[model samples]
Target chain A: MSRWEPDARGRLERAALELYLERGFERTSVAEIAERAGLTERTFFRHYTDKREVLFAGSSALQELLVDTVARAPGPATPMEAVAAALQAAAAVLQERREHARRRHAVITANAELQERELIKLAALAAGLADALRQRGVDDASASLAAEAGIAVFKVAFRRWTEQAGEKDLSEFIGESFAGLKAVTAGT
Target chain B: MSRWEPDARGRLERAALELYLERGFERTSVAEIAERAGLTERTFFRHYTDKREVLFAGSSALQELLVDTVARAPGPATPMEAVAAALQAAAAVLQERREHARRRHAVITANAELQERELIKLAALAAGLADALRQRGVDDASASLAAEAGIAVFKVAFRRWTEQAGEKDLSEFIGESFAGLKAVTAGT
Candidate 1:
């Protein structure tokens, strides 16, 4: 595999997204993306199986970041706190590519298949986070609930961050969304 | 549409589940499902667009149950209370079909396509519940959060209910799961 081609994957992703936007995801071809990225088709194949994967390439990394952060959370911290910390950590990684993320979100939402893939990725991330929490000694039910609620906050906050016109940071949006989850669930 | 075909839909669903389990979802055919249901291919098309829709046939009914329950919740109820009430109400409809729900869940979890469809159904249910909450004067963020949390609780509780050997009712499980969510999210 040409995985060590240094930024080849990133270049292909950028080119694919641009072409997908211009010609629709279905019309965009892997060869065109490779050509646009100034890389051979073989290099593109080494990096991604197909065009759809270019958009989903970051799912595993984000999942690992969330799982690692939750696993390392202080033992005394509440489950929600641990989840909040994990979201903030993930948000920090995402903040650097806000524009790219926004564009990717638009492309995904514009297509049903992409949206399904996105939901599946989020589901996997939640499961990973829950498993990590369980490894940290949290019980099954609590870990699953905390992980799900955290993902819920992440989804809602990410949408808000992508749509907002101001300069608000993704972490702030994540924190506010977590607080909103608490407020919404708080009994009368 | 043969929407008024007496018991045809029910028969098809039962037949579909049996065939899906016996032959596996990928190998199951619409013709076999229609034949097993003692119906013709014509009747099958009258009911469902495809075999996949057989598994998702109940989504619309469930969505309506949730939306209507939320819309009719007590005027002063918190968003979460409204969601909890909605879930309990929906649970009543599901409780009578415990065996069938268990079988359906098994088929869904056994297949990636079915799992994606399940997630899509849950997403649609959340959107419907959120809109219902908004109609009841809940704020946007609160509505979305409560709806997502309700779905999370439902998903976890339903899994527990299905996996348990005892005869506990679905409503009881839902109530317990909602409480578990509160416990999970409670911070120090």
Candidate 2:
């Protein structure tokens, strides 16, 4: 029914990034985004709760995916290993979404408020991973420690992944960063 | 020379906490905070950036203190030991401000937006510590890992320190958590 003909969600996200990048995030409105997408304001609302939500549409899903990945991880793995596996799973999921990921990253990095929201979301994801580890009988301190380490690894890997071009892989970067972080901290 | 005869900053902090507890953060403004503190808007701005800032005035100072503590630490200490020393240093700088810390914690907890800002601030502080460690000749990735691990230890210890009734020393709690995390990740 929409003129753009792309999947509604993708179209909405595309419309949002264009607008948010052109005008600052605080200046962009939902109606403007809807118009750009060739979709109705109603459809836009259906896709996103508000202008800010457009900036974070995938965050909730990403958190859920991270938590589920941790939950379903194979038993017998150390907490750090379990988290590394979950991050690898996440990288696999994110690999196909490079364009979208880069767009979101640019938007977030350009705005302090959005960056703060993004950090908070990552913190929530870290907390969820810790909780999942705790559910697997890891002690609270161990769970949080491993979870925070996982976040550090993920962050460094994510930065590396986005900084490069080509068929470069997030999982590979994450694996290297994990090894690097371990080496960085090891035998000390 | 300031209004309220002495320690205008303390007076503003107290007044702001009162207002924030009575009427949530979003509803409070600079004028209201200044008025509650029995000072003018100029005085308020002189002491703090804005309403949200009054609660976080100590964080930058805390970061500087921690960084200095890490930088001045004897080079022979392991990363964890160095961070532990910095954390104990924080306890010394922070203990006298316990009431303000509790008030700020309550305010930050009450608002998701504030929590985001707080997390970002913590992330920045962690990065600063990592950079300081790197300056001490710690390798890059390991510096971050140790800095983050130290943050984890501080978080655990601070939580315990805040929960206990009066007479609980924050330094001891920090030491305990430091030992605990080192034990948890000791062989890993």
Candidate 3:
């Protein structure tokens, strides 16, 4: 067998999610994940530090996408508009891998520890978005509120997208959720 | 030493926060907390399940206050208005214990693990607020969005209150944050 494996990271992630779903996150082992992927444990370690890391490997990339999108938003865009654009960019990324996202979400929702980790990652994303907004000269409080409100919309929209059975685009849900947020906060 | 102790819970909480701040959360132990409080470890156990619980003992009460406030808002109050009221109620409670809240905030800020726990508690409070909104005849999406937006305002405002040096009231910060949130989301 070649020391270099093709799509090793992707294979390991799929294997890890499948095993986590089949046997639960706590009961699954790194060795089992690697074995299921038909890759050696060393290859698994090369991709992820532990079994849990497999579930969150994309978080950094997602954060970068969100921050970059927010940073690149038009000068005329409001803080909320910049954040909305960022959320739409993130939704586009996830839309391409709906099945994988669904499986991963199921696995995460089943475990309390994973849920806490997910919350932490979401919080980090919000912080990143807030920093990006602040760099645009948005005030501290407004930046933080806009970033957090954007995240809240993303959370609601993502859940709705995952649960509903249809071809409805995640971006549509994002837009709808943002509008819902606006109307509710408008005190109407 | 008498087995019965008055204010045992409060004493344990204060001791735990002091030890956590002095030695860091990872370095602090329940035994040391009890010793610092001049109480038995058994008393500490009776009040809290673990050392971390000391920092979060008020979370349940806070969540109850939030949900109850939302539930009891005047019949004509909008969802956002109800959430605003709940946040003000929560802020008022924290205002009475400013010193303790500040110290606890410092201790949690210094520890990643405790930060995750803090996020989880906030998420739970958001969920409780959403349920209360739903019970008030608010739709599913609106309830969640309002609840989450309220939490976002609370987070930004609470951090400002703790970090700023002034005689300003927390409720004032909460009101300002809600106004900030509305302004940002107004896309102006």
**Predictions in order: lDDT:** 0.88, 0.80, 0.93
lDDT of 2 by residue, B104-142 (tens): 777888998898778888888888899989999987666
Clashing pairs in 1: none
Off by over 4 Å in 2: A1-6, A18-32, A165-168, A184-188, B1-4, B18-46, B75-82, B134-140, B165-168, B180-188
Every candidate's DockQ is 0.71, 0.39, 0.77
Docking class of 2: acceptable
| Consecutive 10-residue window with the lowest summed lDDT within model 3 chain A | A1-10
Q: Can you write out model 1's per-residue Cα lDDT over A54-102, one digit (the tens) per residue?
A: 9998888988888889888888988888888889998998999988998
Q: How closely does chain A match the true chain A in each prediction, as TM-score? A: 0.94, 0.92, 0.97
What is model 2's DockQ versus the real complex?
0.39
TM-score of 3: 0.96
- Which tens-of-lDDT digit does each residue in B74-161 have in candidate 3? 9999999999999888888899999999999999999988898999999999999999999999999999999999999999999999
**What ranges in model 1 sit over 4 Å off?**
A1-6, B1-6
Instruction: Please report how far candidate 2 places residue B91 from its true position, in Å.
Output: 2.3
Q: How well is candidate 3 docked (DockQ)?
A: 0.77
